[model samples]
Target: MKKLFTLTILFFSLVAAAQTEDATSSEINENATFQRWAIDVGAGVHKPTRPFVDGYVSTPDLWQADLGVRYMFTRSFGVGLEFGYNNIQSDADASVTFESDYYRVGLEGIVNLGDFVNLKSASSRFGILGHGGIGVGFLTSNARTLTDATDHHLNFTAGIAPQYRVTKNIAVFTDLTIIGTTRNHYGWDGAVLGTEVRGFEGLMINASVGLTFYLGEGTDPADFAQDPIEAKVDAIAAQMEKMAIENADDDQDGVPNYLDRDNTTESGVRVDSKGRAIDMNKNGIPDDMESSLNARYASQSDVQTAINSANAANQNQIKQLINEGYVNVYFRFNSTKPTTYSLGAINTIVQYMKDHPSATATLTGFADEIGSPEYNKSLSERRAKMVSDVLAAAGIDASRLTQNGDGEDASVDKNSTDARQLVRRVTFKVN
Candidate 1:
């Protein structure tokens, strides 16, 4: 009884300490095993505690067999009922060769400690259980030829079962137990032996191995198992985010400081988008549309004519801007620095302000959809300040430049890179 109490305590301690987060798919399925209804059959040996029932008789050939069915309410706890046959044999030297056939039916409370704890090991397949029960044991002995000799006694049982799961539906387990009961006609004096004999009337060690078959459809294994594909995808996304933070650049032809280096070997060579040297006239922007109208065009009168025609068109756009009272300048994503493409628009505003000294321009900055509102608001404010600083540097009065930031308040096309670029910009209204 003390051993049983000690074993029970140890089992609960193991369960409480084994909890962790790394349970594998197979471990998950193994846990699912407990929700099943099972049938088991076993046969093994039992060693009696009493040295002599009626007299000094050397007991031998001790054996036991069992058949049972169990239902698990949860992975941790269950209940079972079983019928058992046991025989206690005596040595040939003993008078009358004492033998007792004990048959009993019992109800048990079972606890599966392993699954209750949920260990983290991926390869763990071992399961441990602790159980106890009570029932009636009918004792029939060779000496029980008389009606008085045949008696029934209360049986108390406690056991530990260690099992290895081979599959979802089947497992092999060994049950080692201590069963206790009493024999009615005890000594040569014909008196029943009392509790002073080994803890609970009498005791025996019963050990058996059996095949357990899960009878019904259990819980699906996939329900709690982690999805490998989804895990991989999440890992890849995290890696890409880290790379973005670290600024991964295979070719150094991108942006801001380190990413701004040209891919070409030549130190001073200006390269186009493909990293080839920029052609003076054959660059993507046609010579006629260029703001400075390249000096190379100065050698050709036809090119000069084309440049003059473009300048006239620029003048007409300027007139339209003046009529409308302002112009808009766009920036790249998350940048406060103005681009050469937008500086022309800024210069036009500068020129218009110079022409009418009473005019004041309000610069409102905006940001793309990629960042948080608070961060975008701060970024937008910086953008507006950058434009205002430029206007001050360009000889415009500080008093005439008023700046504002709208953050991500306005909607713009965000379906593509080029579209989102349009949102990161500053607009102007002259009054």
Candidate 2:
């Protein structure tokens, strides 16, 4: 009994020292959670590790088989306790071989390092995994030979198992283990007439086999998720690319698209015809827009040397936009009526006002003057007032809005009706 108790304690320590597997799926799924518990049963040959004590009588047989069960706390990790019966043999002096069986309870720690490695997670239908653990047990003999005596002792073991996942709940695994023992139970005893006992005593050796089974409730169907670290990194990279597209300065200059003073430089001293930075106009503004009419380049950096300047954009800039309050509104054809989609934009504006109560907005409205200036002027004023009402409804203080009307007088395109219509729209310039 003392031997059994010591063996159990040794097993516990072995299991305690084994490493635990980390959670694989990002989210917790109830079914998958249950798979955390599993049971394993195995059978294999055993070799004792000791000296000067023989379980085998003279001329007895030499090998024994062992059997046991293990319980897993995690699909990827588990610990097992088991017992086995053994047989020891001797050489021919007509000396009889002693036979006996030992009862054992050992704690085993295990890990599943998936497909490419050792173990599998229930989340993946097919994955590879690896597992390892240590165990200890008790031994005793029930034989009549004077030298065939049994005593209390402990067994130490280490093993490596590599398995394949057939399903989230089931898997087939194989393992090789090196087992060790604390006492000698195979060498010469007082009954031995020869100089040496042919049988071995305490020793360390290896064995291998394959097993298949269900993990348990913890390894449920829903425990897995689409959240792989590789996928997350890929998504981040894609977002960065999109930002590069948005911040590319249309007019090639040292400054980026977000900082450009003139977004579309058709006729501006700050930009060129292609909407690039240049001082050809002689004015401080870019030459491309001014077309040699005025502005001059302030510095060489201000010059737009390349037309198709493709520079990588910064992620922080895009992230900053998200962090800061922002609103994007898309309008319909020549209609001043606010659509449902505009509510999203209005909500953002509302948030902005809540965050910065002192912020101001200028609501300016324009109209294509196909009609008389008198009529268009009134139309523009009405449109501006309409927008003002929306902002007020959304919680903006009415007093913060400075309203203006540009009656068909200014058009983005003097030649096209559509372009003229586009110019005749409402704009809120926040300050």
Best by lDDT: 1
TM-score of each: 0.44, 0.37
Off by over 4 Å in 1: 1-34, 55-62, 116-122, 182-199, 219-431
In TM-score terms, candidate 2 sits at 0.37
Q: How many backbone clashes does candidate 1 have?
A: 0
Q: Compute the lDDT for candidate 1.
A: 0.61
List per-prediction Cα lDDT, in the order shown.
Answer: 0.61, 0.47
- Tell me how candidate 2 scores on lDDT: 0.47
What C-alpha RMSD separates each model from the true structure? 16.9, 19.5
lDDT of 2 at 67: 43
Please, what are the lDDT tens digits per residue for candidate 2 over residues 1-431? 23433544554554354332233333532223444444444545544444434433433133444344555443344465545445543444535444445544555554444522422334454443333333444444334443545444445555565545566665555555555555443332323223432322344343434444554453252112222343467678999998897778663444567666656433222443444546653433333333221122112222111111211344233223323322323233345665343455455455555656787777667777567888878877777887788889878899988888877756255664334434555655666
